[model samples]
Target: MKLTFPIVIAGLLAVFSSCAKIEHKKIDDPAYLRVFNNLNYTVSIENKDEEQPFLAMLIDPETDTSGMPVSAAIVGDFLDQRDGYAPPYPSHVGSSNSFKNPEYPGKESVLVGPVLNGFDLSSWAQIPSGKHRVMFMFRPVNNTPFFQLEERLKKKVLIDTVLQLDSHEVYTLHILQKNFRTKKNGMVLRQEVFHKMPLSDSMIYVNFYNMSADGFADADISLKKRIPQSGLLMFGVKDVMNVWFSLFTNDELRNPVPGYRFRYMTSLRQNNTSNVVQPYYSFPLFAANGTDGIRTTAWQRISLMVPGMNPENNPYNDQAPAEVLGNYAVISCYGNGTKPGFERDILTVPNMIVNIHSGTNNPQSFATVNTIEIVNGRAYLTTIQRKYPTPIY
Candidate 1:
């Protein structure tokens, strides 16, 4: 009886092997991408392909103007919460947790949401890889998408472009909030190849953000160290990257120059205007015990903040970002305010603090960088301006 049972099991194994040999297994290895909404407002995006386009919102802003679709960050926060990853980002207002972004992790499965809200911090969207004609449009907080892209872009702000992607590689199309200059030309959405930050403590990279509301065309931006020129990212914001620093520095000068200091100056000139350009601000590039908390190299970011749509924001919030060194940053306007005595040995110096307020009216501080650290990455959040610079031409 045991021998007979063994023979039957062997025969069953042979049948399974035969079936396995005949069956064909297929594998798909497409490219990958992720969208990050860094603009201070809600945004809807879509892949404009002829055959099968990728759309973020189920409701079309063009067709349904008021169907305010949630943003990538909002969606990401919700998904993470549902997957047992969070209590949910603060903005989640639905009641279902069965949601999944069909474009990633798996095919297009529906998402069940729950009601909650969050700061929408670090929310990112993963998408199928491919070449795409991406259309990025702005939707107000209520999700009321009210304009045909072609018509809306004429009077409003949007970005349209084509991009190629590869398998397993993650890409980011970060949106920055700049002014809408429809009469100028087609402005592509603020995009960047997001490299995962290196884990090393001494790692350094520059994220130059331009949230200036100068009401001018895209300008030629550059960074200079008291020398000759040139220059992350956001919609109206742009970053001049590719700068690196040693995890550590030598106390003594490496070259023979008698004196020693590394300082920087930034220049911005409107692309549509005359060649008359000016230096924004200048500051020391490094500080003692810098990487720990200094501004120049430690912060890893240099932002240009100019007041935009929010008129009240001008000069006050727009003047300088409230940061680690606000006491120094907000006052150093080359003319106005005193440079208080502080232990410079402990803090890093900022390079881009500037008087973006009307140079004509605030000439004393105009074309001058503020001494305070202007919060560069964010769009909103500032104290009411108790006073404004004199209006200039």
Candidate 2:
């Protein structure tokens, strides 16, 4: 009887040990990718269609016997969305609140990479390193998810190309409008390398990019005319402008702050196609003190200045009166400032003061790469987060 019991227990252990493995498998030889749909057709007077900008990205589609793709994996849906901070939560106090709408939810839009306020790589999607066929097709902006959407809705391909991804490399694919007049759009793939910098608690890394369609020769004339007279002067014959990071306390503009400004940071005539990744420029993370553990937040107003504009003058100050062409404000990282009233009031206004600040708590918790992208005459900020501790098992 004892021998029989031992044999039965051994058999039960074997059965328990051999249970099928259920886990989310990790990718092999993985490469990281993030997609941003910066394509703007609103400036197009004739060809602007509301549905043309919304795109669905397909990778390695499965083909049928007829050599046409029967099914595909959707990597990105609603690619018209931009990366940035999320909007404030809507108040549920009233039945018919101003923020309540069936068509638009206040949720922030994002791709397959870092989310708004994310500090780590947990959200970035991983794909096998090799050559893969990629396609971006126009999709309707509806409740239908990309995978469930009918094939008829994805027939129109805006971008079709093969991407060669290297092992352990990171890439950002940008869909930018090539020409507003011809309604042409294209994609620019940038291999991102986070260059190591001297460690400092007070400095933040940033780079500038001019992705506006106004750079193109065939850009819409109406768009160019929309630029304020001060901004046009800064554009000058070369369409070049300098970016200034001015420290402000209360309401005073403090330029001449060392290492806070860049001369001719970007040229408006150059598009993302011709873009080479600019070197990271370090700036003081806090305006009051140049060191950490002092203040949790610091505000700075970014101004777009003409190359010839005297650096000594403070554009933000009415008394000093510098030739500051325009300035940018962070309304929402998700591009929510594009709404009708907000767009006209905040985005189009030249003298409006838009102040961007560091985190309100634990400012040194994670590092960030702030990319100031200029589209048309306005500026948008996209922050790429990095260097936060991950869970160790």
Candidate 3:
């Protein structure tokens, strides 16, 4: 099937608004249907403000011809490392002398989940002009005789023509999966090990496309909300996002001591906010790893803190810990002076939730929260801001 239409610019006066009209035209073509391996993903629709209208579609691979969606319930957040120390290295003592000292490192622990819930699509379609999409994929656990996983790996999801708007609508025609699929199981094992490593919990990618006959254009992501001066928010699938750190031991174990440094960095920006806030912290801890690797089995720990009901009243002390909040944390990353992670990489978690301690003065008590999710290690977040229609540039 093929989709065709003309995107009219409306008069030479040329103005762009959140609620601009969309026109689409469909032409008859060959009736052959194209199919591929199981396609799984989440699609979101937003109007002009670029927020709201967030929707999730889990294509059941077994019967969903469109593609099957991996059950998000199985994904959980769990911490595997806490209060752990780093490997030991040789240090210079007196002139030309080398010495190794016993050091300790410690980290708190927490677990993410097997289930990711709390999503709403009603608001997205109501926005003036906001749309977005989130997708995820997971290979079945080994030795488990689950037919669903087997079926998901065999189906292909296609994006031909979306029926949301009837005019000037360009359908993204492609079948894609976020997770890696290999015939060999060894690669999967490598991925498992890498998953247990201390890498950044975020991924960034760029795509170039032809939106019109004029030429090719590049699309970038940025955070759309104003950084909150107070209150707390959650990021990540509370159950599955995990953090890990490893330690190695050498021959300096005489007295047996452990110590290390700690540092924390956090950032926040609100929708349409002109500025962002970044803060950093430092601390110390103790860690110890036995000479035997047997004693060094994998461990789970909480890397962040989750906020409480009265988080606002204690704005200064209301911050959620890393473990309870999971591995998700706002960073200083930006695009052209704009926060990028929220719009493209981390939109699945609620974007921004206003905390009204004494109660809200604006009747629009409707809080604006962005959402972010992960698929194959990539983060997708979205933000929507409302503003007066500005003249077309």
Candidate 4:
């Protein structure tokens, strides 16, 4: 009897050890990828039936013996239709609580990555390093998940291409409109430099991309009236915009720091024909240490000025010429928080102001790189959080 009991115990131990070996193993030397749906469209009198911009990304779809897609890996499911970056502040008072509620979760709420700690890599997906067959399908802007949706609804494939990705590299795929007039769309794969830039303590790095649709004419009649030239010379060259920045005291619109002139930024090429990885432009993060004697907060406004405008004077002042006033494509500034408010109000709940020192042992302060994506005449802003010891929430 004692011998039989010892043999049974030995068999049980072996079976349990085998079960532990069935755990999920991490992928070896994976590539990271993130997708952004930047495609913009408008419904007007000319074309009343315009397709919405919602999408579902499928990578290496699995098929049955009959060649039907039985199942596949879904990288991005119902990527919410966003014209620009997600808002920085909570759109409404209680909207921030929705992300915590299990019953009502948000899109891209749970991201698949190598690790969720140490950086804001929640938007990235970890895939095998090699050639990947990617497909972006049109999806309805409804509450249903991608897999739960009807098979017929997922038939429309907008972008189907094979991408060769290298190990340990990061890439951002953008779905953009080829031309606003033609309503054609295409994708641009941008390799992101994830490494931190060599910058001073009070500086942030930024770069610009001119992804504005081709043949996009400014429809602002008031701007045309101010310029007032045959063929509207200003409208003829609307694709080009000069970037400008100004520092001001808290809510002090009437007065700005004296002698702070706009610098000449590199002219971005039209239609995203410029280099995929543009050179970074460094800007000082003005300290709010009350040295200026106005308040403990300083605000910086970035304006996109049209070509031909003189950079010698302040464009916001009334004393400036009408042509200068009308030439601005868009102007943006930092806002309250990362969670955008309900309704996504651009004016009130604008771009987030991330504290570069948030996740570190250093004192908390606002310092972050503002990623400004200009689409058509509007500018969408999103701040990149600096890496620190602690993970970014």
Cα TM-score per model: 0.31, 0.64, 0.19, 0.70
lDDT (10s digit) by residue, model 3, range 1-393: 443333344532255664465442322221111111112112233223221111122222222455554353211111111111111111111212211111100010111111112212111111111122223223222323223346655233222122222221112111233222221101000000111223221211111110110100011112111123101122222222222111112222122224311111222211111112112121111134442311221111112222231211323232343322332422121221233332322212221221122222221212222222222212332221222122332
**Could you tell me how far off, in angstroms, the CA of residue 79 lies in candidate 3 after the best superposition?**
35
- Candidate 2 has a TM-score of 0.64
The sequence of per-residue lDDT tens digits that candidate 4 reaches over residues 1-393 is: 356988999999999997764343466877767666775444455556656677777788775575435567544666544534543222222344332211101234332344322235444556778988887777777767667788777677788788888886767677777776667877888776634345454565566776767765555443222221111223323566677755554454445554333655567556654426777676555533345321124555555556667655535344323243235442435345222222121222133344433453233444445566655544555555444445355
Number of the predicted model whose lDDT against the real structure is largest: 4
lDDT of 1: 0.26
Q: How much is the lDDT of residue 61 in candidate 3?
A: 23
Most accurate candidate by TM-score = 4
lDDT at 125, model 2:
55
Clashes of each: 50, 2, 118, 13
**Cα shift from native, residue 170, model 2 (Å):** 1.1
| lDDT (C-alpha) at residue 164 in model 1 | 67
On TM-score, who's better, 3 or 4?
4
Of the two candidates 2 and 3, the one with more favorable lDDT, higher being better, is 2
In terms of lDDT, model 4 sits at 0.53
Query: How far out, in Å, is residue 92 in model 2?
Result: 21
lDDT per residue as tens, model 1, 1-393:
357888999999999887773332232443333333322222223212211111233211222354333223212211110111111122223333444222222222223211112111122233344655554443322222323234432222245456665654443333332443322222222222323322222221222223333342233222101101011121123222111122113222232111212222242222221212222222233333423232221111222323122222324332322221211111111111222243121223322222224435342211111212111222211110112344556
> How far does residue 188 in candidate 3 sit from its true spot (Å)?
24
